[model samples]
Target: MGRKSSLTDDQWVEIERRHLVDGISINALAQEFGVNESSLRRRIKPNKAEPKKAAKSLQALAEMKVEVDAKAKHFAEQLGALPFAKQQIVSDLARKLTNTSEHMASAAEISAASSHRLSRMANQQLELVDEVDPMKTRAQLESFAALQKLANISGEMPGRLAALSRGQPPEAPPSQEEVDQELALLLGSGGG
Candidate 1:
């Protein structure tokens, strides 16, 4: 008797495919796989044809038909289709309502939380505004006033210099009367 072969079933299937599907010669396969030509031929024999379901016996066909009909009848009687369909619609509506309510609740929560956060942020900004040093503001206002006074003095200086260059005495300081009249006009009182 020939020694048992170490090749697997998959290997045998590949050898068969190469011989039958690829149309390789069996002698070549026999030589490559180191198997006797007769053994290789036996291993590559065509598979037996499976029995066709369409070739069922009359008894089996009758039994199957009875079972299918009985199942159909049972399903029709037990389903209570109209009520089951209505229940399905109600269940779907209930799920939709639950989802809508949950979504609304989440939106409301977000709105409320955002509003609270915004209010806190606004308050913090107001607090920061309040924290501004009053002395700094007063210093800036005083500096602005000083700059305005300096600008007025500088503007009159050129006219004074021109008068001095023409050998005329520099313009005399404003008289108290003239100063008083200008102050009255600026104070919205009719100039006296």
Candidate 2:
């Protein structure tokens, strides 16, 4: 036997919203309103008061907009989109909708695209925030590790020089030339 998957809160809400908005389908929305199918379907069938009421609600919904920019942007961040990619996507969408200029939906306060841009921006920002914090942690760890290495070198260095002065072969201090070579390599050939 297959296991039954329970609907999440969001799924239930969406189902109920659809049912309410579309005029409940008796067979499809039985669990949506916690009702019986046959009885509910009968009740839904071409009623005198119901159709008119439903029609009025539909008209209102048609005139309304849910304005999901905040949620969309938040979700976008949760999903991890790049900043430029987010802007490009929103810009393209805005241009498509506006059909005149490429910069039509450029900001969050302009039009319907503003909501979409905000979502994309928020998503991208979340990704950036997530990435940067980890990188900063890694950099701190690396810096601490480097300092530990330097401390170890400093500790051993005096003893090595003392041994050299006592007639053992001496290791030389790191020269400026070697340091310059290392810096050049680290900076890359282009100097960028």
**Best model per TM-score:** 1
lDDT of 2 by residue, 45-113 (tens): 446557556546655766553446667778678547667787788768877877633353232124333
lDDT of 1 by residue, 5-119 (tens): 7677888888876865577887998889887887776555533253223223434776899999999798666555659787677669879999987786566555555545554
| TM-score of candidate 1 versus the correct structure, residues matched by position | 0.24
Q: How accurate locally, in lDDT, is each candidate?
A: 0.60, 0.51
The best candidate in terms of lDDT: 1
Give the residue spans of candidate 2 off by over 4 A: 1-137, 176-192
Candidate 1 accuracy as lDDT: 0.60
Tell me which residue pairs clash in candidate 1: none
TM-score, model 2 to reference: 0.20
lDDT of 2: 0.51
Stretches of candidate 1 off by over 4 Å are 1-82, 128-192
Screening candidate 2 with a backbone cut-off below 3 angstroms (N, C-alpha, C), the clashing residue pairs are 73-119, 76-123, 77-123
